[model samples]
Target: MIEIFTVDAFATNPFKGNPACVCLSFMNDEHSDDFDQLFQKIAKEMNLSETAFITKSSTSTSTYFLQWFTPKNEVPLCGHATLSTAHILFDQHLSQSNELIFETKHVGQLKVRKLKENFLELDFPQGQPQPILLSETIVEELKQKLCIKSDIKGN
Candidate 1:
């Protein structure tokens, strides 16, 4: 039987944060396409926002490949999912290293460090947000959609 773990990522309490199911081992009879279908089916069955599949890394012996999927489609990156995967690895003695590297298809390699017994740090790519001007009509529409009646405060 395949082992599946449900982890609550970014939560101090259980079931408080984004929870994802992690699958460590999976075998496909036919090929890669079959694996994709199976993975999607498992995610759909789990019915979580994200499910992480961990596979052996084709390149590095120490690192592992991680793929995240939702009930609908595959996600390129997920911070909380990655952290949850790392937490499982360390807590369960899946890896010996204090820092574990996970390879991804779109986001490249991610680094996760076991800071302490219950603490972990993830090294993610830096993202910069750009501000855009919004028309009054669009702003008003957004406000109506969001049901914000109080005065808007600018940060």
Candidate 2:
């Protein structure tokens, strides 16, 4: 069975901050077509906002393959989940180095470094904003639902 950890990201105490479930795998397991489905099932079962799957890279000791999943679908990137994954690795003494690299499918490589006082730093790449046009009716509906009074601007 795979090892799982539930962590509170960006919190010094328990029951605070965002909670994320992290799944750790050590073996060089191949990702079959059913692997993502299995991960989705696990995420659904966990019932957390986000679940992270971390697999140790066979090529590099300090690098791992990371994937994030929500209860509904897979996500491209999640900051809290990434922090939780790094926390687990450091807490469990799974990594020998102070720096770790997480390879993702959509977001490329993310670097996490362990600092003094049990703090962890994540070097996340800046994402470019994509503009989307929205209909006035939909915007009005959203504004009404969100209780927005001022004008809502969209691309």
TM-score of 1: 0.77
Residue lDDT tens for model 1, 1-155: 77789998878898698898988765122114346778888899999999998777666544787888999989999888888888888877645678888878888889988887778999997767888777777777788999989766433
lDDT of 2: 0.85
| Whole-model lDDT per candidate | 0.80, 0.85
lDDT of 2 by residue, 66-146 (tens): 889999999999999999998888777655568888888898999999986568899999999997899888898899999
Question: Listing every candidate in turn, what is its Cα RMSD in Å to the true structure after a full C-alpha superposition?
Answer: 5.0, 3.6
Error of 1 at 107 (Å): 0.8
TM-score of 2: 0.80
